[model samples]
Target: MDKDKSIDHQLRATWQAVAKMYNEQAANYGSTMAMAFVLLTIDKENGTPSTALGPLMGMEPTSLSRILKSMEDKGAISREKNPEDGRSVIIKLTAYGLEMRKFSKSHVYQFNNVVREYVTEKELDSFFKVTSTINKLIADKEIYNAISQDK
Candidate 1:
């Protein structure tokens, strides 16, 4: 058994590599990977609730705020008060934003296709299983609470 190889370490390394790859590709369009992600997340038609965007993207409100502001300034997105709920806001994508979203979606699909070409069906299934297990464990607070209890 190789104790040096940890699941978290592997996940971190894989994510770092993926992020770098995305950033490199996004640079050609004069945008960061993060911006492309937000573009892709927003609703192209009906628009999305502003309060829900952060949780949907698994991002901190402060971080999301900066991205939202940048997107608004670029005229890629617009914000308006939600008619149903005046206290809340809605995020709508502009025509330019729709174009950018399509571009971002294409890159994401290309990446998945490339990965699928290399990874087998069985391996991919197992990878999803592992990830789902990890998510469940975190949601249940099994790992953290267990260790804290030991100490």
Candidate 2:
């Protein structure tokens, strides 16, 4: 087989493995990338207003509301009226959510370590650069812009 095909096959296999791992966790939490992004953002910001989070996650307002409501129902997130903007609602992680975040932490760390073990540091850096470059082209820039505008 040609080198390019061989590499493609390996990449696909690796991606499948990663997807399987992600699915195992995501299924348990009823999580998607949108959900994970919200969790990660709340972790970083302590809390964020609903209108702001909508664009950040590239989700429609209705979809974001549904996800937030589910999280709230699960006791994974709490919503409060924004002090500065009473019309906007703020979303925060509950203690249970924080604990669930911790559950994913080790898995994420180990996944990184696994990748690092197989790929050199320079390769990892290159991968990140390429990944970001591709994402810039593919990711919804409008959504990002809307989020920034909110900020």
Per-prediction TM-score to the true structure, in the order listed: 0.93, 0.69
Off by over 4 Å in 2: 1-19, 28-34, 137-151
Q: Output the number of the TM-score-best candidate.
A: 1
Per-model lDDT:
0.91, 0.75
Tell me the number of clashing residue pairs for each predicted model.
Answer: 0, 0
Give RMSD to native, each candidate. Answer: 1.7, 8.0
**lDDT of candidate 2 vs native?**
0.75
lDDT (Cα, tens digit) per residue for candidate 2, span 1-151? 9766674577678778887877677778766544655676674446888788877777798988887888888888998898998898888888877876665665678788987999999998998896676577557675468778999
Off by over 4 Å in 1: 1-4, 149-151
Residue 71 Cα positional deviation in candidate 1, in Å, after optimal superposition:
0.8
Give the Cα error of residue 25 in candidate 2, in Å: 2.1
